[model samples]
Target: MTDRIRRLGMTAARFALSGALLWLLLSQTDASALMARAAAIDPRWLAAAFALTVVQVVLISWRWAVIMAGLDASIGTMRALRINLAAFFLGQALPTSIAGDAWRVLKIRSLGFGIGTGVRGVLIDRTTAMIGLVLVVLVTAPLLLARMPDPAMRWSVAAGLGLGAALLALALSADRLSGRWASGRLSGVAEFGRAVRGLLSRPVTAIPIVGVSVMVHLLAGATMWLIAGSLGLPVGLVDCLVLMPPIVLVAGMPLSIAGWGLREGAVVAVFALVGVPMDGALLMSVLLGLLLLLVSLPGGLVLAFPEPGPGQAAPRRIR
Candidate 1:
């Protein structure tokens, strides 16, 4: 199918899932009750969530900047930030990985990174993000088992975690392999060598980029916790940090279109083990996702007529 058709189909599906989620929230949940609860939420906590949200966005962009700077390239922090927002918007809104990752590559291209360099760097950026996800789960899994372990669930969590670590290791190993292949076989090996060399030769930048990437993910868990508060669930801050990311990692699987009802369902399931209602958890997922989209929509404006950046050249589209 064409990209236009896929997007339209995804839009229709997202609308349908969104409607279903809203219906569940209204029909099963006491909207008035939740709203009253939300309204009565501690102002200090809400203020902190807002502050944390801004900090999360800025720090995530900075993590990307760490990678870009390692490559000896500098994109305006504002541009990097907006582009990061755009990527997040796509990552959430689109059904499949291809479309969303494509959008990321394009946005970087529009900012003036040559296609190859943009894609190469984006790959690393995403890999680091994956690493960050693993770090979140690693820290949180033990806590969950200590408090709420089911034999089957514990086993499942362990396997899933092992898989995550393996994936991250694969990503790091892939970089070495790609670097070598870029040198030995390809026509543009020289550029690959240069980009790889530029990216790897700088340990000074690597330390901070990886560190900030881990923090960026930790902040994401905090955002999930705050959103939980928005629904009056009162899950522990540490629990929220551990619980949400793994479910989100599943939601991000390419199987679902736009994550749709699947993400909410998973959130509801995970929290239900701790006795939070499925409907209320779904409500929290819906609201958190909505806020994310609200923050990320500015990307559409940036994308409408994008300006090229200081990077190498725009990447060529795979299709």
Candidate 2:
């Protein structure tokens, strides 16, 4: 009971912080202008953005499937898609972003897989995706440095790439050392480590997962480009490619609900560096958030009628 109360308190605190930050951002901007811009956005561009979002979902789900295959738990592409969408929706709608991942862990466990296997798969998938994000930023650092003349922005880009490289190196080294420690004093730790290493050892498997992650981000960037176009913002695809990765990485942090305030703030700051208007950037980010919410609505249906797994009985009540 005490633990449950603590969890509730923490959840409430996070929601409050998310609401506060969102309100603060909106208060500082011209709400009327943002609304007008949104109102004027081209429907066709929104349609394009939605299509790109669908593609992003499919690619990401495929990546998840690949990760599961690495674990020898190979699920079908369609099933992966369903689970991904449902998890995404829950992640956004729940009090915390990790709620979706928890749902995923539960789903996997329900399928008679060990909790460790489920966790390992999720961790590897997340790690590969992060590595892909960093790679995107590193790969585009040169173009960004040349195009954007802001010294501060250049330094920021340099720092981000350096951090990304360090993280990748650390992950690789940890995977290598995990096997050595598996039979050591910390058997549990070593076991988890071995699991991570096992999933990541094969380049033939890991490379494609990373590639899919990169493709998903690219599609996401393109979706942003379409949103910018809808808002009549002067941002280009190259600008989106250069800026979106870091913005996304930051926004994905568990700091705010569904990345509401953090995403808007990041988009506004990055677009400013490239000379795009603040209002337009904020609007574009908001639109992207809305489209995501729309796409995730189907997840509600999935939740309502969750399919029973093997050796399990159907729920008598959904509410």
Candidate 3:
């Protein structure tokens, strides 16, 4: 009953967030006018968009595996791919916060490893992955800043660059703090600290993971470009690449249900800045959301196969 209620709450939250975004988008839009504009798209492009999304899924899996491997969680590439696919599918079908993370955590648990290590490994992996994302925005921000055209986008770029710097500092610092605080023979808090410190001590270890993560985002941006192309919109891959990183940062925020309202609003704004029509951007956002949801359906099956264990302790994914 508690679990059911929790799921229901998450669903309701997601529905509300999605609903609010639709409302905001529609509030400024004339449905008839937008539909008329949308009629210009070729139906074949939509199919192409689906193909691009499949590519994105593949890339995401690879990136996830790479990050996990950095933490010494040695799941084979194929298994890691399955795990990432399962996590993504679960994230889309179920509540964004609960499902995707649960799938990852549980899959990691199934690997016949310590739950604590699996959890920490996933955490570290995500941190490394996100660090890579930040690096992308930082590295590319200057390259794209001069071409942003709009003052707001330029400002957005600046802000993103600053944030990326801050995150890098934190990741670099996390290891030192962990060493200082975790350098005891303790098993609880100290153990965690030691583990964190150990991971952080090898900054070189994280670099490759960060590089792969940036590549993953690039692939994802290409997927978005493909989607926009499918809709017959004139969106360049560079535009998608530049606009994608910041929007992802927004989507990761927990303020909205799985980041629905914010995702559309951010994408629409960025798209418009890049000279894509507002309505077209809006349409593409909706389409992308649908595509992701559809792709994640198999996560339902993955979710069903969660490892058996104690009350709430999930299984490991690597041996």
Q: What is the alpha-carbon lDDT for the whole of candidate 2?
A: 0.81
**Which of the predicted structures, 1 or 3, would earn the higher lDDT when compared with the native?**
3
Error of 1 at 135 (Å): 2.0
- The global Cα lDDT (0 to 1) of model 1 is 0.68
**Residue-wise C-alpha lDDT for candidate 1, range 1-319, written one tens digit per residue:** 6999988777676667756855664576666765666566554555566667778778878877777766655675776787777676666666555665677677666656677667776777776677667877787777867655578878877887898788556444443554554455552544543554455557776666667777877776787787777656768777777777777786776555566566777787777767776556776677666666666677677666465445546556698
Total clashes for model 2: 0
lDDT per residue, candidate 3, 1-319, as tens digits? 9999996786787788878877988888778867886777666777776777777677656656655665677776677767776777656555566566666777787676667666776666566667667777777777568667779867866886787778556544543554544345433444444554565466664455556677778876877887788777888888888778877887777656656777889888878877887778888777777777777776666557743434656665696
* C-alpha lDDT of residue 221 in model 2: 88
Per-model root-mean-square deviation over C-alphas: 6.6, 3.4, 5.8
When sorted by TM-score, best at the front, the candidate numbers are 2, 3, 1
Query: For model 2, where is the 10-residue window of minimal lDDT?
Result: 174-183
TM-scores vs. true structure, each candidate: 0.75, 0.89, 0.78
Candidates 2 and 3 compared by TM-score, better number? 2
Deviation from native of the Cα of residue 279 in model 3, angstroms: 0.8
Off by over 4 Å in 3: 1-14, 147-156, 178-208, 304-319
Regions of candidate 2 where Cα sits further than 4 Å from its true position: 146-153, 175-204, 312-319
Global lDDT of each candidate: 0.68, 0.81, 0.70
Best model number under lDDT = 2
